[model samples]
Target chain A: MNRSSQHPLRELAERTRHAGAVLRTRSLETRARVLYEALWALADKKAPSGRHAREALARTTGLSPEMIDWSLAALPIEQARLLMFAERAEDRVPVDLAGVVLAGNVFVAAIEPITAALLLGAPIVVKASSRDDAMPRLFRAAIREQDPELAEALAVVTFPGGDEDKERALFSRAESVVGYGSDHALSELATRLAPGARFFAHGHGVGVAFVVPPDHDADVTTITDALAIDVCAYDQRGCMSPHVVFVEPTEHVSARDFAIQLARAMDRLGQRVPRGPLPPKVASQQLQWRAIGEAQGGLFEGDGFAVALSSGFRLSPGYRNVVVVECTRDRFASAIDSVSRFVRVLAQNGQWVTAPADCRCCAMGEMQRPRFGETRDGIPLHVAFLKET
Target chain B: MSEEHKRRASALIARLAPPHAIPREDAWRARDAHLEALRAFQKAQIPVYGRLSERFGALPVDVLRHARATVHEASEDIRVFLTSGTTQGARGAHPFRDLSLYDQAAKAAAAYALFPDGSLDLCVLAPSEEERPESSLSYMLARFGEWFGERVTIAFREGKLDLAALSGALERAQATGRPLALLGTSFAFVHAEDAFAERGVTFALPDKSRVMQTGGFKGRSREFTPPEMRSLISSRYDVPASFVVSEYGMTELSSQMYELTLRHALNGDRAPIDATRRFFVPDWVRVTAVDPERLQPVAPGEVGILRIEDGANVDSVAALQTADFARVVDGELELLGRDPDAVPRGCSLAIDEVLSAGDGAT
Candidate 1:
């Protein structure tokens, strides 16, 4: 297809390879300039504003635009501040990541690591996810207009997945492969990859919101809104999305009331914005919660609020809507334990202020990833390739 | 419901009728409920609803409210199930406290499906016996057995398919040309097709032949499109693909959706259809076609998430939001596929891919 010529992936990969060299071998001043130039190129393409990227990223990561901007804007600062973490650099560790098999989630994933890849000059073969399709297509169009060589180096192609040969071939050549998928899927992928490769695997981890008894009369709306961040964001598709919301039935907001408010908040968003479907499995799950087998049960769901199945239907890994469950904290924990094989864990309103040790999800570094870079088996990141400050 | 009955017939006979025919008829046209009314067996304490009342309240309407309400007046949502299996899995135990209102859903469908043979020998793809309450397939087969009588078949045990007995039965059925209506899964049927093909036996099912391929398409090699599946079977038999219908089922609701291929739309044979589980959606069902991102419904016909509020399910508050994407065609939902843009993080890519691939939205 001449379309391949219109935006040659070879050229894109080459240019990206060049840019990556600059990113990896060049000084911080050069890195800063390249990022700034990339920004300009992005602007020249007349692609999308940071707001559009922000929204897309938000939809993917579940982080608000404000949060994204704050994060990205703070990226320069995070970089500068992280300059102090020179002590934490893993360059000293003997490691080599032959390539990173990209899974699209958010712009941050592509952009953040590109900085490191460019700086470290690592060869990365990215398999753009459908989410990245829009960004890369637009960006490729932009790059073609401004400069085609850079686009070629990126070699971002959309191949139908399950082409095991392609993936195995790609993984076979790489010393390290980084990717994100559900714990179940990622572990399977890990099995297929070179066993010796240092895997930067992102699978699933359960995210639970623990409601603490706040000292003040906290606005139920406030707690509900906070929980909504993890549920409604990305329509609860991200690993970061809250799967089970643990409320005391007596916390700052009663579990029943919290669920009601949460559902209302989601409804408002759904009506105002209407989140997408629940995850495929979750959608199919449509929790068939029965009180018959429960060790203890009895709770109220406020008007419009319904306690949902923890493992109900997941249409595209999203909530059909919210299912608010009311139970003892231990039961809640146990229930979560039953399903939280590999998922993110969240503590809302500083529930972390109480037994931080009891927090099921603690790898704080996993939090910011709205999409991609998820863990499948809770495998710790023994090393990461960071940009040279 | 099958407890006392299963004792009577060691072999549960699930009469095989296309969902498009039976439930659709019951839901759309049948006057069974109107001419011969059904009173709530338990009123607020329906027997169909068992322990759910403690958390959700009464039967029927309370279960509907459990998932439906405004700010929500229910609590402690629990495990999930598929459509046909829920009531039967746990001994016909409804999620609510009321048990008497056994399917208070007055038959709104009955005219569509013709029960020419009230009792047909049924072949199913579920477990032959009881299993963990969570086994959707097992519960589903049990329900089918309860509904029909003693003519039942199973191909599963310990979460594995029993292929040998299964192949032999299909072989016998096909070779004899026995007037048997096949019921089970699309995948299992496909396998049977291959097995018969290998044996050089033409599975020339009878003219009044019907197959109710349920949701449990487990134990199949690949996901076969309806057209492909039809071709595979039609190669051996003269039956129309229209007779091979898909049964859409979920554990959350005591309802099933069917892909009732048209026998002949020209013949004003539109039967009673379930408003909740339409061959496609009717006006009664409020569907929210979503964009997922702007968190808003897309332009009509544009693909988005499919959310439903069928009053048929409101009795149990089963208003649903799903990640399955679909395109609206003259109000009928053409299930395009799952949205791969976002699946839960770290979920198995293969299972996830299977969910997204052609489970595809248009």
Candidate 2:
């Protein structure tokens, strides 16, 4: 059903409708490959000079062929084994989703669900942001121009900035809207979807790493390397990206020094990471908020104490790898209250656990246990829904 | 004291400051002698910095302290980069300062600027507790509020200025004659001015009611000269333009440049205008009108980029190149405009270009 003389998008829609004609018994692997091929075909093949779309994608997603080869070659079929590991989780729906929406994160990491959906043979409609993950957007184009059959199965388009109208439309046809963003915005967007659309959302999260004192017998290198991954990856943008760090301070590590060390790690990763735009409004707002810090008994200078901070890679006109506050370990959670009580794990004795020894109230806050390592805002993948299904 | 004595005092005080501080330069110390000292110290009392002892070499002082102040003084601290993605892009970096220096400078600047006499009812219309972080405005306001009182009276909603809170603050100030000054950015003042005026409510002026506005309308499209803004304030409130003070400072420098109208002063040009209203450097700040590009001081009255050396940022990066293009007229600093896209311009790129790239990045 590849659009020969007819419109390819329509053909893809029909093909998807036919492929997904069966409500149940769909394969996740089958669904993911079809979606990938479709995206590859739909990519913008002829952009202006030096306007190399692939290069741009590589620059943004940090997924040069080098990284992809590394990923495919080095890593096994080990897919981190999410909650619905080994097999797709089960859920019920009356109809095939008319469209699929993709949220941008680390491209490779963000595409897992798509692969699963292709396995299930679902057509995907991606709404990609220019923030991070440029590779997938480009690859979708490469796949489309290179192969039309795959292109027909996928629809990929990138908007410089997000448009709620387009999102609403995509969400409208979608039997279920899969999104990744903050909880607040996701629920709000869900309200705009067809009255009874399924919404898979990944709300904000703050990844946690423990500051275990390296044992004389322990491999300090292993500890540092593991901890550094939490620091260096995506400049720490994943929902699983570490925001507030809990260093179980000992004679070896001070929380204060650890904060600075984490900041330095981010600094070293600055060139290797993406420092995106901070809206002018955001900068102005920050300055104004900084002005009002007097109300909070805090200062915004690089004191690296109690205040929550943006990462080393930020959109501020002149961003920095700043650990703005030097909060005692006790106040770390409260410092990043904006992200809510999600995705934080205390690092004590070299183990990752959400339980805090001193936190009396629920040991958890007044909030629910949020998607602890969820990166980006609330957006869900159709395949993950299938996985759970 | 004579003018000579005042200048000498300011110079001496500035010199006494240990070349201000630069935190980036201190990063090199992990390979030097102070690494162990820094690690050892933070390992003990300084809880935030002791963790770097393992993978990286240590330093003499806590990294936070060094990052905020000591390293700011290093001229070549490469980490402090100007935003290359444009819009009033200058080689501006938020210089770091140790906890003490930041606090002291916050108190000094706020007190010296607003509460020069005594603590009064202070309210801010700018971003407050809910706003973005690591901003000098937040630091200054927070310090001012704590030293004086948490009297910041603006509420925020949907990440914007709460016009209602501003209105309520004005109404409260008017009902209560306690002298209150409105602190916020020039953009906020400009954006909200008409809204304030249309309500038929002039800013409620307390005894020595004043508008101490920070930030210039550098990137704003609707251009309004300083005098025009002064006029806006003058006509809006029944106060003379002289009562409206414009404070020009950046997060990069601890000192500020101020412009006060001498219109209402009884001792016009005859007696020396009080140093309080004059434009110059504070003891901790040194302002030089340089060729913006070469970093060479321009002749008096010649418009150039304002480069300042502040000892206050001892924990962060030191010297800063401001986005504002300015000139020194009679030892008083007068701003011209923002530097357009140019290399050797802070990040040496155009504002439009930077903004577009940022859009891409976002």
Candidate 3:
């Protein structure tokens, strides 16, 4: 019998599961402290590993170095927030082995669930996307450097997606799994999990912004600058990143004027944290999107970004390409009614139309920085980890 | 349309109404003259195009979504062709004051491409235009049956494929020993393939039998690449691989593009069958690869979004831009489909990706 060959995930899962038992014996304060220290090290710009993470992520993630730096600097790694979530994990029975399937789309997407798992003292086996494993690997390294004892509870492994045998090995042992990707992918992963194992899916959703007619006292520069930050964050890749900004024509500025101003703002921001290298296919798509925008209304383009003033609204395939639609409040609601289900975040400067039920509303610039307790895709972060009765 | 503009438009349509063996330069001359006339006619006759051209500098094909793009209002249209609203919830409609030009253009192109040898029995796996007025492909297939089909069998009714009826059509073609043309959307063909597999049935239709499939899977069935689809259709229908033709037409344009495999084979030019398939436009339609940013023609052999000028689109805008990415090689289009990386790398779902799922072209 060729017994020498074993799936790598099997042993890794077993090791983490065993470590989770010991990890659970520690007080919630210690586990939270260990997790916070590691995150803090990565978030610190002065730290070597922190700088290395930004550089490594720039290479691995198609984002530019400046954008990577901006993204890393924006990560919400506050220890107080970590402790707040940690207190919720107190007196709860930790999951035996928590399986995490990370996607390559947004590198920072791997953080929250992994934090929830560790904060609850659950040993985690992470199946890092082959396209991006730097964040998970670097995170594990940070944990190892901070506390080797807790490092035993973390394992980051990489294999091509749809490797069912390896996926089965991880799914069979874990009591819970959190998968991220398109909805189709998450569904397939759910089918392969162990019978009783619970599945938490962070599927793809869209983000939109609304700019109401500003008050007489409102500053246009402040609004456009903040909105530009929301658009440029993650190169407009995150679900929280706004794809379209619906601007109401005020006595002060028209929608076209707003689009032109936003174009300039994107240009100013691009100079600071330039848009990343776009794949050829994305570049082609961007062109088509711009042409469509031109046909629909007018287009204002700049270095690495474009602001399209469209008569109607559609989500732009984000790489800092944004659509600015002018409409009344009634028209705005009607336009978004059909796509309300996919709307993740509705960013606005002031009170506009009522948001959809599952959508999270935030100020224009703060779309990407959701507070710790807020629900993602309608699921609270605290509920992500296993909870004991 | 105004009487003067309609008269000029009709004259242009009449000049390029047939698919003939005209020289390349001569063909371009006639098409360009027609394109010029059609653009002027559209801007003059359609109020919407005038407004759009003034506002946007050029009328893009996407403006077809606006009701006023049509010469006549939707309510007064002699016929309106609706797009498959697969990409977005809103469907684009191309309204016409007259259907004669559209019919003539469709028949001429299909005859030159799919039915090079006059009319044959057509087993259409799609609803007739009378049944589904919104589907332009359905309208064109129904026209194919009326103009050329000696015997017609529509196996698709009310959005479902009648497998028994389709089997009967195949059996009839075998019994009569006459060539048959099978036409349907790609997803319908996939369903037929599945049905045949389940029934343990395959057909060896008469010689010269061919298949014409159009449209993408659009999440309707299991997706197969173009080569795989060609092989599946050829084997399932027991036809020569070259006889399996794919049609590329959209609701926005009156003209359609077709692969030249069947035509070349019919002309006794036997090219070795490979995965590569290039669609040839009719003499009346000229396609150019335009850089989306510059809105200008790209260098030869470079891939860009397709900008098609159809002389047959007499009532609407002559110049239209399609989202499809392609390369124009020696007047033939090598469709690379939509941008594969159009979906962002982040967790945010692009609505276009969600709406046009399984949009296989290449």
Index of the highest-TM-score prediction: 3
What lDDT score is found at residue B67 in candidate 2? 34
> What is the C-alpha lDDT profile of model 1 across B1-362, one tens digit per residue?
31222221111112122343344343423222321111121223233333443332222221332333211122533423323321212122224322112122211111122123454556665555465455444555555555553455666556555667665555666666664556666666666676667788775665555666655333234777656766675565556665556555444443444554433321435543222223544222345565543335678777765655443332243344444566565556656544344442433222233323322110
Error of 2 at A2 (Å): 31
Candidate order, TM-score descending: 3, 1, 2
Give per-residue CA lDDT, model 2, range A1-389, as digits (tens): 32222544334445544544442343444333334344333232333311354456555543333333332222122223332332333444324554444445445443554444443445455555546545455545544454445444445556532455555555445565566554444556667566666666654344444345454424444444344444444323344444334445567654444554544444443434434433222232233222223222232233211122322112221222222333444655454343333433333332233443222121111111222123223233333334223
Candidate 2 TM-score on chain B: 0.66
lDDT of 3 by residue, A18-83 (tens): 998778777777777777777777887789879879878977888888877777776646677777
lDDT of every model, 2 decimals: 0.44, 0.44, 0.78
- The prediction achieving the highest lDDT against the true structure is 3
- Scored against the true structure, residue B23 in model 2 reaches a CA lDDT of 43
Higher-TM-score candidate of 2 and 3: 3
Model 2, residue B166: distance off in Å is: 9.9
Alpha carbon lDDT of residue B153, candidate 2?
73
How high is the lDDT of residue B25 in model 3? 75
Deviation in angstroms for B204 in model 2?
Answer: 15
Error of 3 at A330 (Å): 7.4
Off by over 4 Å in 1: A1-24, A32-77, A82-87, A90-98, A101-107, A134-155, A163-173, A183-197, A218-236, A248-333, A348-389, B1-125, B128-177, B190-210, B216-222, B236-362
